[model samples]
Target: MSGRKFAMKKTKSRRKKWASSQLFYEYSTFFRKNADNVIFQVTSDQLPTLNRIGLDDLFMSKGHIREPHWHPNAAELDYVVTGEVVIGMVDPIRHHLLQFHVTPSQVVFIPINWWHWITAVSDDVHVVQVFSSAKRQIIEGSNVLRKTPPKVFQQSYDVNAKQFASLVSPIKETVVIGPPDRYALTNLSDEHPESVPRVVNHTPPGSPNLFFDLKRNLAVRRDHSYLYEVTSTQIPMMNVLSLGDLYLTMGHVREPHWHPNADELDYVISGEVTVSILDPNTLAVCNYRLKPGQVTLIPKGWLHWIIPYTEDAHMLVYFNDGKIESVEGSDILRLTPADVFQRAYDIHAREFTREISSITGTLMIGPPDRPRR
Candidate 1:
C-alpha cells in the first residue's frame, strides 16, 4: 500500500510538470495571408513540444509563386497535396539551376541553404513543406533584391545600375507571394524568349533524385488501413526529412512502436485519431486526441501508438531523419525468449510462449484478424 501510494504521488507530480508541455496546435488559427495566397506554419514557437521539425501549410492560386527563398537552418521536403507546382532550385555545389514539375501526390526535396522557389501550375495549389529544424530561418529573395543597392548589382554582375534600380522599384517590401498584389497579373503561358529560360533535359552525373511520387510507392496495405512512405532510399536528395502517409479505419491502431532514429510529427488530414506517447522524462503516458488540421509531436525513441477514433482517418507523419528505423513492439514480443519474460516478471513461461506464438512478424497494424469491435 505504501509503495502504491508513493507511485501515485510521483505520477501526480509528473503530471503537474507535463501539463505545461504542449503537443497539439491548429494550423488554421495562426497563418500569414498574402492576398489570395496563405502560408500556415507550425514551429517550436507554436507547438512547444516540436523539436528538430516544423511544417508550412502553403496555399497559392494559379501563376503565383511562393517567392524565391531558402531556409538557412533547415532542409525542406515539399509534398504537393493538390493541384500542380513547378519547383525550382539552384544547386549550390554544382552551380546548376534545377527545376521539377510536381503534380498531386508528388514531392520535391531541397537541401539546406539551397535557393529554391515554388510556382503554382494549377489553381488552388496546396503543398505541405516539412523542415528539419524546429524553427526554420528563411532568407527571401525579394528582400535581398530590394535591400541591396543597385550600384552593387552593377559592380558585381555588370548590370546597368539605373536599369536594376528601376526593375526592382516595384518591390516595396518582403514579397512572400509574387508578383506583388499591386502589379497586374500577366499571362504566364506567354513565351518571352529573352526572359524565360528554355527547359532542358540535362541530367548531370551523380545528381541526387529530388522528386518522388508518394502514390507510386505503397509501403503496406492491410484491409482499409494503408501506409505510403518516402525515405532516403526512395529519394537520395532527402537527407534530414521523410514522410509516412497513413490511413486507418475505426478500430485500427498503428501498433505500439518507436522510431529509433527519428522524431515524428503527426498531422491529421481527415477524421480523428488518438496519438498516445510515453513520455520518457516523466514515464507517463500522454494521449492527444487530434482532428483535421491538428498535429502532435513525438520525441525520438519514445514509445508511441496511434488509434483512429473514426473511419477514414488520414495522417501525414513527418520524421527528422530521411532513413527511419523503428523498433516494433510486436517484434520485441515475438523475438524475446518466453523464459526471459517469465524470469523477469515471474510469469508462466509456457503460457507466455503460447500466447505470443501467433505473432510471427512485425505487425504494423494491430489485430492480425479483423477486429470484432
Candidate 2:
C-alpha cells in the first residue's frame, strides 16, 4: 500500500468514467542500479493505464549511474530493456551485499527497500522501472548514496571517499538527482566487469501474456498535481495523440455521462463492463465483460455509459484525443451551450487551426471528415 497520507481526491466531474483532471505522477521508484529494469517493453494492457503507452528507439548511456537509494513507501520492479547493468544491493541481514550483475533479455524485478545501484556496461542500458509510491516519491531511508561522505562510509571498507567518489559518478549522479549531463564512466566500468551479450531490450512476448505489469514507467512529480505527478505526455503538432492516460473503473450500475475533447481509446484494464453510446443517429448500448486485455473504441461526439459487472470491474481508456484535449473537457462540462466557446476562451478558429491540423483535430468546418475503417 502507498504509505503516502495524501488522498486520491475526486477533483473533477464525478460523472466522468476516468478521473484525469489534476493528478500528474502516475508513481516513482529508485532507478540506476538495475540496468535490466531499464529496457523491458511490454503490451499496453500490462500497464495500469488503459490507453497507449510506448517507448521507441531509446538508447541507454554507458556512463549512466543510478543513485544508491531506497524508498520508504512503494515497492520497485525493474526489467532489463536492453544491454546489461552491474547491480548491487545491501542485504544487511544476510551479512553480504545482495548484488547481481544481471542480463534478463526481457525483464527483472526489484523488491522494495533494496538499496541498490546500477551502471551500463558496453551498450547503453535500457530499463523499465515501476513504482507505487505517492507522486514525487524520492530515494529515502537506508541508502549509501553518491553524496554520502566517502570518508564517513570508508575505513570500515578499504575504499576511501575519493576512491568511493570514483566508484560513483557525479555527472548523472546526484545527491538526489544529478544535473542531466551525458557523462562517460570508463573508470568505473574498468573495475566492474560487463555482462554477457544480449538482444535489444524489445523482445516479443513468448505466449503474448496479457497480464504482465508495466508499472515501472511511473514517476513522481511534485510540481504537478498528484494525478499527473511525474507523468509525462506527448502532444504532436498534427493533432495526433501519441500517448494518453487511459484506465477503467467498474460499478454494477450504469455510469454517469461525461465527455472530454481528448479522444478516449479504451480496453479492458480488467473485468467486464456494459457500455452505452449515444450519437445523434443512434443511442446504442453494448454490454461486454472484458477480461485482462480488450480494446473498446469510443468515437467523438458520442455520449457514452459503462455498466460494470463485477463490483470492481475496470477498463483502460485514452481519455484525451489531441484535438479535443483536457481543456475541451473542462470547457464542455464547465460552460453552457449558449456560450461561444471560442470567444470566451479568447481563441479563434484560426488560432486553433494553426496549432492543430484539420485532419487530427477534426476541425468543425462542417461534418467530420474522419476516414472510416
Candidate 3:
C-alpha cells in the first residue's frame, strides 16, 4: 500500500503535456527575484508556449546594475520599456566593446556568448530582454570569479595567491543584480546638479548602436496597419536578428504569409488576435486566439495569418535571422500560371486569370474585398 501510494504521488507530480488551453501566460506572474533590483522571467519550463524562446523583464532602481553575464546558448534582444539604461557588450569573436546609451522605445541585440551588462540611468528603468532559446544558460561574472582556481588567477595576471583568495573568498554569495558599493539615492535639491538623472544619448563610435524607435518613420504604413522593422538596411552592424512591431486596426488582418529565411515569434502587446499557421509538410494547422500578454511561435516556411479581435492590436515579431524575406499568399496566387491553376481547379483559364489579376502587389494587410471564410 505504501509503495503504491508513493508511485501515485510521483506520477501526480509529473508535468502535464503542453496544451492549447495553456497557450496563454501572464509573464508578470512568472518567477521573479529581487536583490537590489527585480527581474522577472518566463521560460519554456514555466510556459511551454515559450518552447523556443524566453523573455525577461528587469526593473532596476537608480544606480542598480544587472550584472555582467553571458548566455551560452542564446542571443539577446533588449528593448527599453521605460526610463533609460546603459548597455555595454563585448563582442566574443572580434574582441571589441559595444556600448550604447539606450532610451525608451530603443532596441539592442547582444550576440550569444557576448558578455553584457545593463545599468539603470533613471529612478525607474524597465527593460525587456528576449532570448533566442527556451532555456538560457547564464554564466554570471560573479560566478566565474568565484569558480576560478586560485592558482590560475595567481598565474594569470601575476597576482599573489593570498590577495586573490582574499578578494574572492569573502564573496560568500553571488550578486545577480546590485548597485555599486557606494550607490545611494540622488537628491538634486541637496546635491550637485550633475547628480540628477540625465539622458544617455550617445552611440559610441564603431559600436553602431542598433537603437531605433518603433514609431519612427516606418518602412510601410497603411491606413489600418503599419510596421517598423529593424534590419541591416536600418542598422548596418547588426546581423544576429531582426525585430519588428506591427499594429492592426479592428477587422483588419495581416494576410497569409511565410518567411523563407526565419522563424517568427510573436508577442501580443495589446488587444486580441486569432492566429493560424499551416505546416506545408504535414498540412497540419495550428490556430489560436491570443490576447494581450500571449505569444505564438511560427516555424520558418509555415503559412500563417493574423486577424485582429479588437481595435488597435499591437504585436512585436522577432526573427532569428537578420534579413527578412516574406512570400505573401496573394503574390503566389496572383503570379501562379493561370492555365495550370485553372486546370487544377477545373475552371476557365480566363476567369482564373481575371480573378487574380486584381492582386497587383503584396496585400500585406488586407480586408480581401470581403471577409475570408
Candidate 4:
C-alpha cells in the first residue's frame, strides 16, 4: 500500500502528561512549516533535539529538479519511495553520478557537505532526505547559486544547461527551517562496540507507529521493512545508530528505570505518551506529556517510564549522544538483589513483591544478538 492513506482516529484532548514539566514537554509539526512542503522535526530532551533543521520530502513532476546546493555539515540520505531519480554530487576531490530507478525499498546514501543536485525521472517522484546533523544545524547554508546567477552555478559545477537542464527541471524550492550545523561531538566517551546490547528491530508498515518490546524482548514491523541489522561490514558505524534521521517507534510501556550511561531523547511522533522521570539530584519527579514534534528527554541515571496515552501513538527516539545499549531493565529489578533497587529508590524491603521472584529466577537470558532484530 505505497502512498495509501490509512485511517487514524485523532484524539479530542491529546494533551496529557506523564509526570511534570520539570523534565518533559511536547511540540507540534509546526517546527518545519513553510509555504513549500511538509517536514516534521521531532526529538526529545536535548539541546540539539529541540532545535529544528530541514528534512523533508519533495514531489516533482516528470522533469522537476532540486537545484545544486551545499552545506558545511549536512549530508542527505535519500530513499526513493516511487519513480526514478538522477543524483549528482561533488566535493573537493571527485564527482559521483548515479542514475537509479529507485523503488520503495531502495535507498541512496549521500555524504555530508557535498554539493549535490537531483532530478525526478518519474511522472511524480517522491523522496525522503535525512540530514547528517540535527535539523538545527542545517538551516542556513550558502545556496551556491546565490553567489552568482543560476547559470553561473550550473557552469561552475560543470552542469550542461541545454542537455541536463532539459532533463532536470526545477520543482519547488522554499525555506522554512533553521540555524546551522553548530553542535560538535565534544565528548563521545570511551566504549567498545562490543558492549552494544542485543536489539530486535521490528515494525509493521502501513502505520506511523513501530514497537520493539525491549523489556519483553519483542518487535513487530507491521509490514514496513524493519531492518534487523547489517553485519560483517567494515564501515565505521554500520548499525541503526548511524541512520540519518532519528529512530521513530512506539510501544505499550517502558519500565521505570534509567541508563546510568547515556541520555535518551524522544519526540511524540504521533498519538500521546506519558513519561515519568526521577531527578537523581533533586529527588523530586518530572513528568511529560509528549505529542507530535514535542520532545521528552531522559537524562542519564534518571529513572524513567513510558506508555501509550491513547489507542497507540508513535514517539521518535534517538540517543542524542548516538550511543545505544540494550539494558535488560526487567531483569535488573527482578533478579538483582533487593539492596540494589532499595538503594536506588530508597524503598523498604516490605515494598518488594513476589513478582520479583519470577523476574530474578528466569532461565532465558543470553546474547540477544542472533534473535535480536
Report the number of the highest-lDDT candidate: 1
Q: What's the lDDT for candidate 2?
A: 0.38
By how many angstroms RMSD does model 2 differ from the true structure? 18.7
**TM-score list, all predictions:** 0.88, 0.34, 0.75, 0.52
Alpha-carbon runs more than 4 Å astray in model 4: 1-36, 40-68, 74-94, 98-110, 116-135, 139-142, 149-251, 326-328, 339-353, 360-373
Q: Pairing residues by index, what is the TM-score of model 2? A: 0.34
Q: Once superposed on the true structure, which residue ranges of model 1 sit more than 4 Å away at CA?
A: 1-20, 28-31, 34-36, 186-206, 369-373
Decreasing TM-score order of the candidates: 1, 3, 4, 2
Lowest summed lDDT over 10 consecutive residues: which window, candidate 2? Answer: 1-10
Clashes of each: 0, 49, 0, 24
For every candidate structure, what is the RMSD over all alpha carbons to the true structure, in angstroms? 8.1, 18.7, 8.1, 13.5
User: For each candidate, what is the lDDT?
Assistant: 0.79, 0.38, 0.69, 0.42
Rank the models by lDDT, top first: 1, 3, 4, 2
Residues 129-247 of candidate 1 have per-residue lDDT tens digits of: 89999999999999999999999999999999999999999999888877777744465457433222344434466567788889888877778898899999998778789999999
- Give the Å shift of residue 67 in candidate 4: 5.4
lDDT of 3 by residue, 128-238 (tens): 678878778898888888788878988888999888888776555576775334434455325645433344555555555556665674756668688877876666655
Best by TM-score: 1
Whole-structure CA lDDT of model 1: 0.79
How do the residues 1-373 of candidate 4 rate in per-residue lDDT, one tens digit apiece?
Answer: 1221111112332333343333443332432322222233332222333322234444444434455666565545555545666655543343333233344334444545556666554544555454444452442223322333457646678876565544323322332321112312122112323221222222223321111112121232322212121111212222222221222234335555555555566544446667676766666666666655455566656677666566545443443322344455666666677777678888665457443444433212221212322
Q: Which is the better candidate, 3 or 4, if ranked by lDDT?
A: 3
TM-score of 1: 0.88
